[model samples]
Target: YEEPLTGEQYRKLELGPAPIDFDNTIQSLETQSKIVKLEVHYHGHPQERFISLDEPDVSLLSARQLEVINETLERLSSMNATQISAFSHQDMPWKATEDKEIIDYELVFYRDPLTSVREYE
Candidate 1:
């Protein structure tokens, strides 16, 4: 085997700060952010249910509609995940009804069948 290079040889091989590949990073983040895994559930109504919408379907939704879902999720995301189900009324706004407790947290946005306008609820 050949002997190792000297310190001076190694210094010569050192290059200045490398150029940042922002394009790759930005592209990666954009691609990853587009794929959101959402778990949906519904309650209060007599027939509780879960919704399963594919990625393509979700992408068809308007930005505003998605914002509402994101904002709602963000609010809950900041809370203690472990004690989420344990939260009482004191931790939230005044209850408008006794069925306010959330049994499902899946978020789905779609346009009204007739109006064709995006609705958050």
Candidate 2:
């Protein structure tokens, strides 16, 4: 089995506060009258977590981050895994683990998207 869960993971298992910059963007988007189409948050199993930051401002995804997120999404799009498993599931080419468990999903905004969210002002 994977290494035991770290104390930090056991501590809260909650979606920690987003990066300061991301917080600013979220605020800005909310202020601009942009409606949030989808706002979902989730936690991964032992070592991973993510957040789905979907909105009109989604265009703000950076190239690298976009690639990673989209790739996982693409794989998920092709499967019938649970909401949590689909996104954080790491099985590929060949199966690895038999136990299927939900993992934490943490969205990181430290990296800016290739495109910027259009400012409304």
Candidate 3:
């Protein structure tokens, strides 16, 4: 490991003062951030589960589509009893489809055509 630079040393090298103090830097580097494990249960069957990098920085569906995708995946995994079987084209948002529709990501779900219902697989 490289030795920690002193304030004078940083200035001599034309580097700005460290953003964080040495102790804080060590903690930040050594300690892993907390992870939230989420599970979605459907009909008493396991569906999906996942580890979140953070609680989730969510609000804008159009801007942060990846987070939405990750959340959807987690939701699918946590379901206890849904059997999603096949993939339908991801629901791409179409202005014609709805007055104000937002289609960011897509995943498959099991649907009974007869009953017209969907379940997680």
Candidate 4:
């Protein structure tokens, strides 16, 4: 997608690029009873899991946005966290940003073919 599906800004971190407000957003959703958060241990590391209490209100998203989101999920679903992080680190947006800095969404336009989702004429 040309634009981000959500307004949340992503930051370049040591692991990869991640939405800065992800934890807060998830907490808010949990508080609102829209979802439930579970803490679990994975390979001796603490991990968080969220379960939705109700269906998401997709009315806010355009058809193209929904399609893009689904396609992205499908593409990444098979990858584990470590692999996904490594993949994201190779993208221009993450590569161009300094550690702890906010990644520029516009950098996506300059992505290399392997990381780019759109075709250029």
Candidate 5:
């Protein structure tokens, strides 16, 4: 038995942030031009894949920075899970904490994105 409200198996726990109560308005992280750097910024649950951008976002980084990013991306893109997964930033087969075996996903970039951010209201 647990405190507060108890359940036999799983309790409807409010583990993370409360749902946003929107009223005739919406907020998004959309960008028009391009993005210099992008990352997976998430808390509570890692579900940032739900955000959709129509087209690719361009990169506005300098030559050296761009080269580094491009080089890293190229190497990483050509990689397969069986090859390596040391540089992963999120949950993956190499970083799994559950009683799992392997990750059932591909780790590669298909193309060069034109953009990576967007906003809505």
Candidate 6:
């Protein structure tokens, strides 16, 4: 996708690229009762799970945007956190960025074949 789903800037963290405002955004959503955060142990490790209390307002997104979101979720749903991080680390946007620096969204256009979303003719 040429355009990002949101305007949030993602930072190149040690694990991978992550949204800088993720924690604050999650806290706000939880406070608003839009979602619930649960602490759960998975494979002897503690993990945070979010359960949505209400359906999303799909009216806010275009059909193409929704399709991209769904496709991305479907592709990633099978992976565990570690696997997802590893997968993200291989992308050019994450690899090219300096540690703790904001990753440029335009780097998506230069992604390697394995991590590329678009097919070239």
TM-score of each: 0.27, 0.26, 0.20, 0.90, 0.26, 0.92
Tens digit of per-residue lDDT, candidate 4, span 8-92: 8999999998899999998899889999889999889999899999988999899888887888888889998999989998899
- Any idea what lDDT model 4 has? 0.88
Q: Identify the runs in model 4 with alpha carbons over 4 angstroms from their true place.
A: none
Higher-TM-score candidate of 4 and 5: 4
Worst 10 residues of 3 by lDDT: 8-17
Kindly list the per-residue Cα lDDT of model 1 for residues 1-116, writing each as its tens digit. 01211111111101211123434544564566743334444343333222333345566556665665576566567655234433322222212213423211111122123212
Q: Which candidate number would show the highest lDDT if scored against the true structure?
A: 6
Give the range of the ten consecutive residues with the poorest summed lDDT in model 5.
Answer: 1-10
Q: Write the per-residue lDDT of candidate 3 for residues 62-113, one digit (tens) a residue.
A: 4335554565666566532213221221222121123223222121122234
Clash counts for all predictions: 2, 17, 23, 0, 11, 0
Model 1 has an lDDT value of: 0.34
Maximum-TM-score candidate: 6
Model 6's lDDT to the true fold? 0.90
What does the lDDT read for residue 14 in candidate 1?
Answer: 14
How accurate locally is residue 66 in candidate 1, as Cα lDDT from 0 to 100?
A: 68
TM-score of 4: 0.90
What C-alpha lDDT values do all the predictions have?
0.34, 0.35, 0.34, 0.88, 0.31, 0.90
lDDT of 2 by residue, 1-121 (tens): 1122121221111231123244456567666645343434435433322333544354665565566556656645664335434333322201221232222222221212322222225
